[model samples]
Target: MPAPDLDLRLVRCFTTVAEHLHLGRAALALHTTQPALSRQISRLERQVGARLLDRSPRGTALTEAGRVFLPRALALLDSAAEAVAGARAVGRDRITVGYGVNLIVTPAVAELRRRHPGADVRARHVEWDRVRSSLLERRVDAVVARLPLDDDGLRVVVLREEPRALLVPTGHRLADRRSVTLDDVADEPMPRVPDERWNAFWRVDPRPGGGPAPDGPLVESAEDKAELVASGQAVAIVPGGEHLRRVRPGLVAVPLEGVEPSRVALATRAGERGPLVAEFRELAATHLVG
Candidate 1:
């Protein structure tokens, strides 16, 4: 005949009794009275349809069935504990926030932490190209990115509409002209937006040459771009916030007269956000915008 279906509770009782080899001690180990243990053992025997213990003058000895079943019983309990623990670990949530150079130290990010205390916020300084990909794959919950995205799958919350500024060397011809127009430095070599963005539309490339064809200086991080301009190495165009002026004293930020400005917006995957992701978007809107 095939073996009977196993009962987890019975397995626990059998393992406890076999470990102690005595009813009273096994009862204490299991935190139960001796009579309850005896009844449990009786129930298990009826279920398994076998004698599991040999009662004698000395104490209890395991029957052949009990000796074979002990290891299997213990194994079942171990598996259950592991499964429960694994499930509990998945319950702790972690959300990823995507941004580039300047947003890392911005007040928006700072307020995000302040509003949501101890929220698991993982900030990744990803390029524009990877930001949407990360959002699509659920690698990140939301992204604070530049506006006019080519992709239409995600939704956005406009944070600010800031003016575009000219990044020029301090001693350059128009660097100290109060504020230079796009026509003023129309002939200088342009620097390209360093971060590799998914869509070219969101990129703020170098306008030093004043024309297409990115043959000029390639700048990556915003702070580094400012340093290059300050040193008179290469000039670039930047947004107002991206030019965190404290560190770059030599660079002059002049508002460009003609070129259209860029809008900074928060991007997130479409549909309803979970509690954690929703909270981040709310806090960003409250503190990031004017």
Candidate 2:
């Protein structure tokens, strides 16, 4: 016959009783009356369909079945305690915030630290290819990512709308132009993002004529893509965030015409209402403009 499905309460009672081998002492340890503990052990014995204890003048002794079950019962109770402890350890003041270099608002990150003094607030610079994966895989607790993300069990808070621009080397043909249209570089090769989640968005696919884009290097990080552009090997349409403009001075960003503005947002797993994630979302709300 199959073993009975015992609940945690029963397992805990059995472990306590087995530990002391005295009903009165075990009841005292468990803060229950002696009679109550006896009933609980009796119930457990009925469920298992085995005589677990031998009662005599000397007190209770484990029968063969009880001896065999004692070790497993203790193990179950120990595991439960550890699981509870592990869950509480999540409050150990550590959380990782992931973001693309361009999507992060510098001031907002500082504010998050100020708000969580005791928290080990850390940053994880995520690449465009891994934005959604990082959050889903628990690599980071929260993230600042671009829009057009699928609503697949995630929550997104719109922080700002960034104007899109094309990055070209200072010496490139379109570099000196005041501003250029997508058509001006229709056939120009741009770096490729092989990750399906990121490829279409970064590629700015469906050119003005609804056609495929010319391929360039298959890249991961924004820094790598910028290198390709700076070396005159490729061009990329990027968010015109102030930080990007300041860091990549070697590349001139010409505002692109007829392109959708990129929505920069804070994203986290759905149903995860942790305080760290909430605080970051609130901070983004006040500090960002979309």
Candidate 3:
């Protein structure tokens, strides 16, 4: 028999209920009553041929089947949203550029806008770890990323290079230093970022002594790393730029020595020969100064 078509509405309802784990709260969040929400869940369960949630007077809990289906359901929702956005962008002279933290791309964006008055240029903030994936997944047409990025299938233009610095708590020993070397921080715990290449580059993994830096708390965002540093739980290496001058109150960035300077680059897919992408890449090369 052919598979049944799944309703996105039902999937959304189930995910919300899974998140809250309570019918009452889920109903409120979905803006529907408990009984109606229960009906929706029942309809979904009937279509899927499995019970997704176990309901009790006290609360609700996911059945084994629900746990397996949740992630796929979320992906479906994400793809649906991306599909809608892509459709809307069709026939429009639009381009979205992604940029990482502490990196600036505004000057290039403004120049692109000035040159192509009819072009719809937009900037999206890309998390440090998502730089490559954002372009590969078509989330952004191009990105301004800090390098040591794995550029296997991408065209990369080196914009500039800048020294890196270590972010430490104000009272830490290294915080008082004019500068420090890899050996100085060899034993210090560094924030654990998701991407291996990124983690290796930022943490200066496999130190001069030849092993990975001591692992600290796992960090997913700049804010997370900053908080961990402020609390003295971990230290992070970042671009030594003007943005560091306004770092969080409890943290300071000390110059890091004995390492290669970080490079800022504009990257797009290898297959992208679009004029807008080409133009923006040229503008970034010209206007993005370190």
Candidate 4:
């Protein structure tokens, strides 16, 4: 028998639903209605000939089949995205660079544009957590990333380092201090994020005495983290840069003492040494003064 012809759209819907595990949330993420998302998931389940998710009023859980299929589904989506990017890059002078929050790349981009008058150079704002993956998946040709990232297969050039600071609510005990050490906020709740390395580094986890930082609300974005701090729900350690000084109202950034500074760097896929990318990397190294 011939295999079932799967629709990539349905696969994408399944992956989005699987990611959030809530129809309404997944729909919001995908910019579709809940009923539409539900129908898409049902169509995918029928095509796959197995129920991938077990949904109830309380919550949603992945079925045995889902656990088995999730990785393959992710790989499929990644491959599709990469293929599209590759197709677009051929015979075109285009390069898209992604950057994390509060990091600037315009000087480098301007230089590159001046050097290659016909090249299409674009700058995109990427979320902190997605910086590394954005490059590996070919979502962007390069990225301006904060350091301590998993640079397994990328060429990273450290631009500079910035002192780290602790962000606390204005009325918090440490807010008025000239500078605070890890011990000052050791017992305070910190926002937890999905990236373990990122979470640990920013939280300064596993303190000198070897205990984990107190976990608070889960955050997925810089705004989320800043909001949590402003609301007095959690504290966060962020780069002590002028641009990042006043991220949210009711929050104050006090210089954090006794910790490694944050490194900012330009990163690109190791194998992509094309002229446009190379020139941009060199310009970034020289121009992006942290």
Best by TM-score: 3
Clashing pairs in 2: 161-290
Q: What is the TM-score ranking, best to worst?
A: 3, 4, 2, 1
Residue pairs in collision within model 4: none
lDDT of 3 by residue, 81-161 (tens): 987887786556889999988777999999999999988899999987777788877789899988878788899888888
Better of 2 and 4 by TM-score: 4
TM-score of candidate 1 to 2 decimals? 0.56
The better-scoring model by lDDT among 1 and 4 is 4
TM-score of each: 0.56, 0.64, 0.79, 0.74
lDDT by residue (tens digit), candidate 4, 1-290:
88877888999888888899998898999999998888888899999999998988997788999989889889988898888977888557899989888788888899888988888889999887777788877788889988778888888889898999999888998888989999888789998888789878888887778999888888898888888888889889999874245556688889988999988988899888677888787788789964
Q: Rank the candidates by lDDT, best first.
A: 3, 4, 2, 1
As a whole number from 0 to 100, the lDDT of residue 247 in candidate 4 is 53
Per-model C-alpha lDDT, please? 0.70, 0.78, 0.87, 0.85
Q: Model 1's lDDT to the true fold?
A: 0.70
Give stretches of model 1 more than 4 Å off. Answer: 1-92, 104-118, 148-152, 193-215, 219-224, 227-233, 242-247
Predicted structure 4, TM vs. truth: 0.74
Candidate 2, 87-113: lDDT as tens digits: 664766667788876555566668888
TM-score of 3: 0.79
lDDT (0-100) at residue 100 of candidate 3?
87
